[model samples]
Target: MDITFLGTGAGRPVSGRNVTSSALRLPAARGTFWLFDCGEGTQHQLMKTSHKLSRLERIFITHLHGDHTFGLPGLLSSRAFSGGTTPVTVYGPKGIKQLIEMSLSLTQTNLEYELHIEEIEEEGIIFEDEQFTVTAAELEHRVPCFGYRIVEKPVSGKLNAIKLQGLGVKPGPVYGRLKQGLDAELPDGRMVYANEVKGPSIPGRVITILGDTSPCENTVLLGVGADLLVHEATFAADLPDKAVEFGHSTTIHAAEAAVRAGAKKLVITHFSSRYRQEDLEQLADEARVLFPETLAATDLLTVPIPRIVEPRE
Candidate 1:
């Protein structure tokens, strides 16, 4: 999986950065990507990247703030215009459906695909499938907001081809059965067990993406043990008071959350407009004081989440 930051500025768009938007591109087998927080000019940002609206499978809105939602309507409409026919599911806080529907209605924009809007009624598991599970929790924002924890299901281990060959097991349909953790009988009546030839299963990655907010318990709860934690650092370390007043987080707060959550890496975005491009490294440096794996998100930056290789017995 890879996360691409489309916009990284907070509050409003600036010359160097746009507002808050990011895309999570899944593996090729999925053939789709999920979007997080569609800030203004998000569609334009998509145009600049390799991501396609037609392949956008899901959208998760953090809040109803303009900086997070203004581009939603336009992007939805453009998706249809660009020949998107697959269904799209949107998950967000209450009033998200109304906002999208009302905007599309007023603009008379017709969608070519089915749009499924799920307004979060509670904080828990909001989405689950065979491959992934998504949990939502409220955050301390000025308005109602949420953070999402996406956990990919564990992947099965690969079959040991060399072991099979060494055992004189010729490659055939029986190999498929063994790969599924089933016992397979060879033509000579020899039994082959999957566990005997397969390596240990790999643990799936955990990713947590948070909305704009002050550091709170839910932040750490949602980000616990995350392989990648995407948190907003809207202010410098010295602006703790300002951060608390505005219900936003500072560099220190983000790093602290990462440390408490035991996150493997922290990617900070949604920077205040006052910070110039050159100053972003300094802000990230502040967070790195506590969490050395901290990285400041830049527009169109892509970060890949690698799979963990388990040791064999």
Candidate 2:
């Protein structure tokens, strides 16, 4: 699992950064990319990268802010022209359905695949599948914003080849069966055990994507133990008053939340247009003081979640 920042800038697009948008790519799971927050010119930002728009399985909006969601209509419509026949789902707060309908309705854009929209409120587990689960937590912002937590299903550990060989098992399809905890029926009618080869499965990665918001206790609760925390830091540590006034978070606030949540890594993003790339170091230093795993996010910066080896493959 990995997160790529498509647009890390706040309010407006900067030279080095775009706006507020991100894409989560799952390579091990056959290269699926879930887009979070379709900010203005997201397609244009994506064009700068090697990422394929057809890989977008779903899109989750943080709020209705233009910087957070102006690229929806174009991207969604262009997918059809690009031969994307797979279904896509969009999730957001109230008025989201209406917003999408209005955009498509006005443009009279016909989609090649099913387009589903869901408007959410309150905290709940919004999405789940065999591979991953996504939960949303209501965040305090100017609008009904939400933070998302993505937890991938546990992974299986490598099979003990030496152990299997010792048991007179040759490497073949049988190895897969053993690793899957299935008893292999030998040609001689004897059963080859799974414990004789497979060890254990590893835990999957956890990632938390914070929406625009002020520092709140729930942020820590929602972000706890996440392998990576992609959070908004609209201002530097010195501007706490302004952060609160705008219902946004400061760099120090993001770092403190990461520390409190015991997150493995903290990626500070959604920066205000007022600052320059040179000034990002000041904010990053403040976060590193609290959480050793700290980084100032930039456009297309991909944060990797280390692989782990679970019993349930």
Candidate 3:
């Protein structure tokens, strides 16, 4: 899995950054990408990247803020003409359904594919499939905002080819069955056990993405043990009062949250417009004092989440 930040500025667009938007590209097997917080100009932002509107399978809106949702109607409208024929689902807060419906209705825009909107009234497991599970929790924002925790399912270990070969089992269809944890008997009447030969299963990755918020318990809960924690650092450490008053987080708040959650890495975005491109490094430096793995996000920055492999028992 990989994350591509489409826009990284807060409140409004600047020359160095746009607004809030990010794309989570799943493996090719999934054949689609999920969007988080589609701020204004997000469609324009995607035009500059390899991610296409047609491959946008799901959208998870953090809140109803204009900077986080102004691009939804335009993007959804463009998808019809962009070769998007498959159904699309959107998950968000209570007002999300009304927002999309009214916007499209007023514009008289008709979509070619089915559109499903889910309004999240309660916080818990919002999405779950065979491959991934997504949990939502409330955050301390001006409006009702949410943070998401995505956990991928564990992948089975690979078959031990050397061990299988030693048992007089040549690579063939039998290898497929053994890989599925099934017992297979050789032509010579020798049975091979899948568990005895297979390596240890690799643990799935955990990713936490939060909406605009101040430092709160939900932030730590959603980010606990996350492989990648994407949180907003909208202000510098020196602007603690401003951050608290505006319901935003400072660099220190973001870094401390990552430390409390035991996150492996941190990517801070939603920067205030006051900071220029060069100033981001200093903002990141402040956070690095508490969490050295923190990185400041820029537009179109793609971060790859590498799989964790476990050693054989």
Candidate 3 segments whose C-alpha is farther than 4 A from its true place = 171-173, 185-190
Candidate 3, 106: how far from true, in Å? Answer: 0.9
Global lDDT of model 3: 0.94
Report, for every candidate in turn, its global Cα lDDT versus the true structure: 0.95, 0.87, 0.94
- The residue-by-residue lDDT of candidate 1 on 1-313, one tens digit each, is 9999999999999997999999999877998999999999999999999999999999999999999999999999999999899999999999999999999999999898999999999999999999999999999999999999999998888999999999898777888898788989888888888999988888999999999989899999999999999999999999999999999999999999999999999999999998999999999999999999999999999999987776765
Q: For model 1, what is the error of residue 100's alpha carbon versus the real structure, in angstroms, after optimal superposition? A: 0.6
lDDT for 186 in candidate 2 is: 73
| Model 3 lDDT-worst window of ten | 304-313
Which is better, 1 or 3, measured by lDDT? 1
Q: Write the per-residue lDDT of candidate 2 for residues 1-313, one digit (tens) a residue.
A: 6788999998989788899888888865477689999998899888877678887899999899889888999999998987788899999999888888999999999999999998886788999988889999988788889999988888666788777777778878887788787889877787888876666767878889989999987789889999899889999888999998889999889999998999988999999999898988888998788777899998888777777543354
RMSD of each: 1.2, 2.6, 1.4
TM-score of each: 0.97, 0.92, 0.96
Candidate 1 is scored at a TM of: 0.97
Clashing pairs in 2: 201-309, 201-310, 202-309, 202-310
